[model samples]
Target: MTRDAGQMPEELERAQRFAWDMESLYGDDLVSVVLYGSAARGEYRRGASDLNVMVLVRELTPAALRRAGQRARDWVAQGNPTPLMLSHDEWLRSADVFAIEVADMREAYHVLAGADPFAGITVDPADLRLQCEKELKGKQILLREQYLLFAGEPAELGGLLVRSFSTFLVLFRTVLRLSGEAGVRDAEEVVLKVAARAGFNPGALLEVHRARASGQPPRPTADSPLAVGYLDAVDRVVTYVDRLVREGGAQA
Candidate 1:
């Protein structure tokens, strides 16, 4: 019983209802029920996709996480599927383990019957920006190395192009999150929105996309035209943060 974007509201309501039902049976120990993955991002298909969810609880006794796991398995056995149940410690500690993407945060609604202990959980925008920048720096280095390594091979060039485009999507999504915009499932849509709101040039982003589509070896240089577009996008993000700091100072 998953659905597509148009049917998201109904699906979300059902998920909330399911969370409530679980809370009633399990008592007040449950922290929150988070709907994750593509369905959470309003991209599920009725016939093909399973809903991904995380049930975060205060302290699951050794028996409880196991029981929860068994219950989830049973749900799948019944032809309704969901993913893991995580305790509070696991979720918080794992939050910074990787570059958080649009798919990671979209459609996250808290469904809790009673007072939620995790209600005040806030992901600092500054922290997210730093994490994103760190990831971007790493990807930029990796892409440059890969390009040099297989400069003559068309197949390797194509693979590097794909990786670079994927990294661009991650960078764009991170900017969206920093700006308090909900994550978008579509990479192109996210890039367009980032360009519009974050003072980036959309034409530049489209150029990167076009280069990626061409399946050609990128020109190698310190200031390669292909690299310029991505670099410009990164500059826009830095400019955005600088503007925010200035505006905040003025307000103060």
Candidate 2:
């Protein structure tokens, strides 16, 4: 997908300005301020999604972070409307647990008042790749085992569907981990990249997504050729990731 420049709505602009004012009021100790998540990814709706952002400081006191969060909530309560304010350190430490995306606006990122914390943060690409490989492999194993148990049990389709969603979640997480920089909410964006790197075909997986979106039942039994095909594709994904890790280690 093509990257587009961030276009702030008037309300968002007001929120940003308010954030900047808060930073100044607290003195210029704000190390960095970033817009992140879906809003940063250009997928957010003005009224539906809250403005997600991160405020970084050289030394963010627990009290300070709490105060900042409260202030943001209070501002939104006043009808300014935007759930803004997250601390950078807190965000980084918990990023792996949640589906948060980093904003990609290095050149045009409005500094507001301080330096960019990411300016010198060197993320090792190889390390990221290996971490994602490990995580994806683990997820594949779990999904395979779960699907095997659910097979032929059409009555348990709902549970199976939830598990299938989990499969997509794991795949999405792996992509985010590999990229280091996040903001990929759509599975379509990273599925191909992950599949190619791990030697799995994305087409088959996409079929599953299409079926799910269409509200069709997933095939998980041997009787259902589609289900069997999906399972086979998933297995291949696991094997491919395992081989990649093994080969990479041998080269190292």
Question: TM-score: which candidate is best?
Answer: 2
- Quote each prediction's TM-score: 0.51, 0.54
Positional deviation of residue 78's Cα in model 1 after best superposition, in angstroms = 17
Candidate number of the best lDDT: 1
Clashing pairs in 2: 219-227
Q: In candidate 2, what are the lDDT values of residues 113-153, reduced to their tens digit?
A: 45665554443444545655666667667766766776768
- What residue runs in model 1 are displaced by over 4 Å at the alpha carbon? 1-35, 43-85, 92-119, 163-167, 180-186, 196-252
Worst 10 residues of 1 by lDDT: 243-252
Error of 2 at 30 (Å): 1.4
Residues 145-240, candidate 1, lDDT per residue (tens digit)? 776776666565545654466556656666666666764667568878888876766665565565555544344343455455555676676566
Backbone clash pairs for candidate 1 read none
Candidate 1, residue 47: the lDDT equals: 40
List the global CA lDDT of all models. 0.58, 0.53
